[model samples]
Target chain A: MLKLDNIKTYYGNIQALKGISLEVKKGEIICLIGANGAGKSTTLMSISGIEPPRSGSIFLEGIDITGMPAHQIVTMGLSQVPEGRRIFPQLSVLENLDMGAYLRRDKEEQKRDLEYVFDLFPILSQRRNQSGGTLSGGEQQMLAISRALMAKPRILLMDEPSLGLAPIIVQQIFGIITRINKEQGTTIFLVEQNANQALKIADRGYVLQNGMIVKSDTSSALMADEEVKNAYLGV
Target chain B: MKYFLQLVLAGLTKGSIYALIALGYTMVYGIIKLINFAHGEIYMIGAFTALIVGGALQITTGLSPLTILAISLAAAIFFSSGYGVTMEKIAYKPLRNAPRLTALISAIGMSLILQNYVLLAQTSDFLPFRSMIPNFPFLTPGKSLVTTTQLVILITTVVVMVILTLLIKFTRTGKAMRATSQDKVMAQLVGIDINKVITFTFAVGSATAAIGGVLIANHTGQINFYIGFLAGIKAFVAAVLGGIGSIPGAVLGSLVLGMTESFGAGYISSAYEDVFAFIILILILIFKPSGLLGRNEIEKV
Candidate 1:
């Protein structure tokens, strides 16, 4: 389980997140959906400790992880696939994935995880030696997610996984996300601008507006809500 | 034909030193994007450490020349690596988020501080450096164009280069370093300690620079506090000429600069040897600013 309590984050003088609170129970796919600059990414970043919240706390599995350094946070089995994928452009796809399990010492387990990720995205295996930058947008996105999965995370925090991908590719990625959650029992905290697809995969969802949560409900209810339908679902 | 071959051999000997020192500049620049002006001082310190350690061992102990050489080389690497890590911590780490110009100024300041510290520690006069390597019995001067020292220096350089390539390509830490150089935040996302990686980079760079310092002292048979200044500047030029962030570029640039200086001095006039290096550098800058092996910055879609 993951919990955020009144977390506020800022970039210099400008506040990007203002006293936001949310939670996700164990093994659930939870999504935070909002438009651009609505602080959805900031929320995940704060939890991941890339940008620590100025106030309040984040707890993962009942342990306070607020304001921890990103590297240390990763050791606690929390991995973030950051916005834009941020894959090492020169590193081969396999090397990029190797970076995900950088802290693990279990060679056999790491090999298993590598196989799991390659199986999840078979296209990645074919391009294992190709540099990450050479991969297409969809392949890169898949690489990014697979790279996170290589960490063997208990909670995977993904930001904008579907951004700039073809609709078919986006659909395929979402289906994989659902499969990853169900099969591995991995808790996912997904942040997205595509509310419709996010809500469809998410067991529960929150509508984030301008650094604050405006609504939280079962994904199906949020999908049908009048305001949510008009604003985010493009109804 | 003999004269030209001799010149090429001389060029390779000089290039061996340049490539070693240039690697420090290129590796540090690759990860942190700082010119690390103080890198030269680390080289100077390496030579001094070797001098002090070797001199003391010769005086107080009856160790064989080979043993003395090994100990002195290790000491040089240890002390130089220490200085490098300390320089990063004291001069650069706090300024990690500061403007790059600020870090560069700090580096320059660190350079001055190191040079002065060494000057105060040891006299400014050139100290004689007895060759670390014993004479090779098989090498006859007239029969072989290369001297024992030059041959040793070349072989050592090749060995070092081969080891470095293996380190950068195969090791886990090496992979982490490559990842960090490419994207620091993403490296952290995967649980790599960025500070540790930065410190490791400084250590590895200084280690190579230390090897250069020891080998150059062995070859030239002399040392001075200010020797690192011109050598550092030349290596920096070589790094830029080869593309500042590329590893192979540094070696290639060093060799190119060395051959130019060697042939230009040998054939034309020795007085303008240094000038040839600068002319080649300027040409490279004017023509291919990225250096031979450097990748142009291509934005991802």
Candidate 2:
């Protein structure tokens, strides 16, 4: 579970998130849909401590984690699959996954986690020895998601996981995300511009526009809303 | 042929020292993107630490020469790593978020401060470094060959190189370091303390420089406060020549630079040895830009 109350974030003098508030319950796949530069990524970054909120507080499982360093935030069981799949280009696939579990010390647990990840994405196991840069776009996205899962976080925050992905690949990724939430019982806070697909899988959704949450409702309700359909779904 | 073999041997001996020092430059540069001009001073401090420790051990204990050498080398590495970590904490860490020029100027400033500190603490005069290993010079057909010191330097360098390669490839800390170097923010998101990795880089890099300082001081039998200045510049050039952020590139560049200087001095003119080294560097830069083993990374827009 995570909660942000009246969070404000900035890039130098320019404000990105102005008094935005949101919440996600445990084991729920909550989607935040917004146009480009609509504070979606900024919200995820604020939670991850990459861009600390200038005002307001963020609570993860009732514990305030607003101003903690990014590394500390990760150790506290929060993981972010950042935009553009920032996998280490030079590192091998296995090394990239190893880095995901960097905070863990138990070798047996790490070995089990590695096996679990490989099972989830068999392509990753096949290309375990290859450099990350050599992987295709779909494979790279899988690696990025798999790398975050290697952290075994209580909640996974993903930013634009579907960005630039092919249509069929996007479907496959979304299916995996659904399975990860259902089977693993992992809470997901996903930010996406692919409103149609996101709304299809999400239990609840929020609409963001120019650094503000314009609408919040259950996925079916938002899908049936005329304004939401016109603006986000392009239907 | 004998003369050529002697020059190659001499080049290798000197190159080993340069490669050791240049590794420090490449690694610190790779992680932090700072030249760390103060690194040379770390080497100078390492030599001084070894000298003092070796002298104290001789006077205070009746230890064997081998034991004394090992103890002094360890002390030198420990102290040099300390100096390096402290320098990063005091001089470079604050400038992490600052502009690149600020860090560069700070590194030069730290270098000067360290040099002056040594001058005030130790004498400016050249200090004699006793040969820890006994001389066992084996002659060749044309009266050209290797000494025990040269053999020791080569073997030690190779061993250190292998160990370093293994450490970087097989160890978790090394993997964290490589991750941080590639993507600092991403590394942090994955629970790696970037500060710890950076600190480790400085510590390990400084340790290698310490080994180089001790070996070179032993071989040359003299060390002055300014010794690090020229050596530092040469090592920097070697790093740049090999591609500033690539480890293998640094080693290869140092060997090439060392061999060039050795052959130039032997076959051409000893007076212009440094000139030959610089000329090679210039030629390499003009032609390759990226060092021999360096990858030319295209910036993603």
Query: Which prediction has the highest lDDT against the true structure?
Result: 1
Across B1-301, the per-residue lDDT of candidate 2 in tens digits comes to 8789989999998888889999999999999899999888899988889899998888899988778889989999999999999999999999998999999999999999999999999989998888776655363424447877788899999999999999998999999989998999899899988999999999999999999998888889889888888788888888888899999999998998899899999999999987976787788889988888888986332
What candidate 2 gets wrong by more than 4 Å, as runs, is: B136-144, B299-301
Candidate 1 Cα outliers beyond 4 Å, as residue runs: none
Among the numbered candidates, top DockQ falls to 1
10 residues in a row with least lDDT, candidate 1 chain A: A41-50
Q: What is the interface RMSD of candidate 2, in Å?
A: 1.4
Could you tell me which residue pairs clash in candidate 1? Answer: none
The residue pairs found clashing in candidate 2 are none
lDDT of 2 at B68: 85
Which CAPRI quality tier does the interface of model 2 achieve? Answer: medium
Estimated TM-score per prediction? 0.98, 0.97
